[model samples]
Target: MNERLRFVDPTALMHLSRGLTFNPLRSAEVLDDVLAAFDEKNGYVSDVQAWVRGGGLQNGPCPTLPSGRIVADVTETMNAERKVLHAAAILKLEREAGIAPGVFLSMVSPTLDVGMRVELPMRALLKGNLPLEGTYTVYLHVLMTSDGRDLVYYGITKRGWSLRFQEHTRSAISRESHRLFARTLRDLTAARARELHGVLDERPKLRGLITTICATGLCHGEALDVEEAMVEKYSLASKHANGLNMIPGGAAGLRAAQRFKGTH
Candidate 1:
């Protein structure tokens, strides 16, 4: 007799009525049919679309139906109609070589000529290491062409120091530098940054600038893990005659609103 423990076997009649009589095969078939119906019914759409349709546009474009709504192709709203990231080649190499984290963060200065090219020389911070432990060092060189269309890439030291991974830079890159670059493009396109620049034209708010920067990066397919922390540290406050309250989700929401409007 252990305390806080009790067990009782059900009577045969009770077990028959409650648990033993059920047909698991039929029950599974019914569940499968329900899930299929749910998927087929287009249940993934949100209520926001319906709400927009219901609300009449007063100051901006006309809103009658799908035709009169202020709708446009979202792809057209992006800087280049699509944002692409190139991690495949680097990932492949890393996989083959069994590289880990915290390996290298070195610089490879480029040579600007008929085309931009760089020859990287990594000092190999760690050697004779296991793959599943820490970050591995991989030398990389990227060049943004003058035309802003082409990218020149070179991955050095895996083989020879000067062997180039031609056109490898065309792959979409996920890095802080790329994040900042995408932010600039979105700001120029959405006119959000320009608006802020015009309004606070004299002395700009530093935190506002930072939030905008982070938000723009998020919009252009980048994520900063500490975004919430950044907002908590930098957002503004409002006070009424009786009391003061912070706007819920302030800077982050503003950024999301801009994103929803295809501004980002």
Candidate 2:
């Protein structure tokens, strides 16, 4: 649960109630009618024009005057001029008021809806598990051997770093030769290299030799651009160094290389 949960201000509610000149006897009914309308729209934008038109929310003919209808009308007016509100607050209000989660979420905006989905895993991660749902810097998993040289066995994923780390470890341990990283390990083994020899003998221990570099966030087109940049920067195009990249970064890198080749 978010500790920062906020509710609709009483002052705002009171002002709205007054604008509708709601009947004291049927205040609940009026509130219900107005809320139902909002629920129908999954909550409108703060500046929604449709809400200002004063349509919908009529329950039926009543002998005790149309106080509920008036309240609905007032709500529409207030909603049109009201500032934007977070969907979480509205959801919290509905929950506290004994409304079902299904109904509350059903009317939430698409953005808020995605946020709600993202929130669950994020909260769980904050409690000491691997994190989720945030912009992450893609990185390179480079192995530094006993010698001064390094070998990049895997490119980091744009998704969760920890999750990707686990995936690499799992794939390497399982000796999935089809995977690029695993294929690199096989190649290194076959070469009988002394410097980083037996590096992949115990795949789990490889994590210690591997260092994750270039952690970044939310800029330069996020991880994809960064990953491509790193790949190009460290590429052993004509060098004697060993790199595990099967593909040459992204499409942009390929295009740039092609242009260079054409000019030369």
Candidate 3:
């Protein structure tokens, strides 16, 4: 009865309407009412009412309703209803929260991994949400010796893992000092340098040696925390023979060399 009309995605509304076909005569009216309810409540509804109206429950006792439907049938019906509601919810969120549809879809999907989730804020930024800037993960890239016995380098980037890797390769091949990883590899012993050179020279080889260890969907401070933790845990320093990290992690990495003298 609340007359507040909330915006709903047309596609999502269509999906919800299609899902109500079991009771065709009242489907249109039910869909209208459902939309109205969502609108009035800022796009949310009571779970029990949603289930009942979504065909997971029906009238009558005994063999007419509860006794007539098997567990699998009820579960299937409930799942179908849930999908419709989820789609509607996502659409509502998109409209009200200004969330990009792709980002909402990724959040609703069941299989999104940590890396993908961590990338959502960046996606939002690309979609013109400037407020999310500097809050996404600064992913860590670990490159290890061919035998995987030791880590060869530790890298962190807010740009992207693949882009940073390409930069490392380019800087190494061009003998440029822009990328510390490439510079470190270039400074290693001949045999070790050649091994890493071959790896960086080939895209597939470079990718194979790289692994993303920690990805977080937190602010820059959290990302720095993760980077520092990884650096300490992995001992990514020149003192570690196999480590290729030129300096310590986080802001400390940017300090002048004088500060770390005789500190080990």
Candidate 4:
């Protein structure tokens, strides 16, 4: 109901659609409160219901036999909860067992290391988290400095962190760069270009300055869930505006991850 509610069943009040984005917290049976008040008097056949009725569909058996009827069909739905109480419970128990939380993102204290080994600690990310293994990792590109850190962008990746970092660096220098990390580097470089007399160097300037805060213990679906939550929390108003995200988190991540998985 937080977004928009449209259906004529008067009882098929699904909170969010199941097709657009998968809400891990949801299952079909948890949809509605039948006891909740519904205004039937104001309820009239919607455009969808009218279309079905126009087709002269009858509420017979089989699909209608034992009072079975299809009122409407919607394709896209998504939802998120901030409390994450249920997931938190399980993660805390995992922590007790010396396993890492399957969903988490936070900045690490800068090791202040320089040269080639500078990214080693950040690549491993959070310390004290065992079992740094998962198909998908939800990560944050944090702009780190001696003063403090700021979130630059968020993403999910199936490739190992080290490989993904290299992929991003390569993508940034490619002529037709459309990758998220590449785009972010382009944006940052452009900003710097203004001061450097219009020199748009797309080299990986962020190599040492960026620290990745990652959640490395979630399965594919769980990773999508956490990615969806992280993106919503730090979504850009416009592409390259506040962040480099061009799409909403959950559903899109699945498609991208699938493609990455196939390729690698």
Q: For residue 72, give model 3's deviation from the true position in Å.
A: 27
The candidates, ranked best first by lDDT, are: 4, 3, 2, 1
Give candidate 4's total backbone clashes.
4
For candidate 4, write residues 120-177 as lDDT tens digits. 1111221222334434666665543222334356677765544555566567657367
- lDDT tens digits, residue span 1-264, model 2: 122212122222222122222232233334334444554664432112232222211322111111111112211111455543222222333223321121111122221111111111111111122222344445455544334455674354445444565566567557774756565544443332322443344232221233333433333355556667667667433332557665566556467669879999
Error of 2 at 101 (Å): 45
lDDT of 3 by residue, 1-264 (tens): 113222222232222122221232222234334444543653332332233334321342111122121110000112544543222121323232332112111122122111111111111211112232234444444443334443455555554454566666667767876445686444432234444445443211221233332442346666667666666566566567556676776656646345766465
- After superposition on all C-alphas, the RMSD of every candidate to the true structure, in Å, is 28.4, 22.4, 17.3, 19.8
Expressed as tens digits, the lDDT of each residue in 1-264 for candidate 1 is 112111111121121112211232322233223323432454311122232234412233221223121111100011254432111011113332321111111121211112222211110111111221122112222223223322111111222222222222122222233432233323322343344445433221111110011111022112222333333443212322211113313346456657768953
Colliding residue pairs in candidate 3: none
Which candidate has the top score in TM-score? 4
Candidate 2 Cα misplacement greater than 4 A, ranges: 1-132, 146-148, 153-156, 185-208, 236-240, 251-264
Q: Candidate 2: lDDT of 144?
A: 40
TM-score, one value per model: 0.16, 0.35, 0.38, 0.39
lDDT of 3: 0.37
Better of 2 and 3 by lDDT: 3
Model 3 alpha-carbon miss at residue 75, Å:
32
Off by over 4 Å in 1: 1-102, 112-225, 231-255, 258-264
Give the least accurate 10-residue stretch of model 2, judged by summed lDDT. 114-123
Candidate lDDT (C-alpha), each: 0.23, 0.36, 0.37, 0.38
Q: Please report the candidate that would top lDDT against the real structure.
A: 4
Could you tell me how far off, in angstroms, the CA of residue 196 lies in candidate 4 after the best superposition?
Answer: 9.2
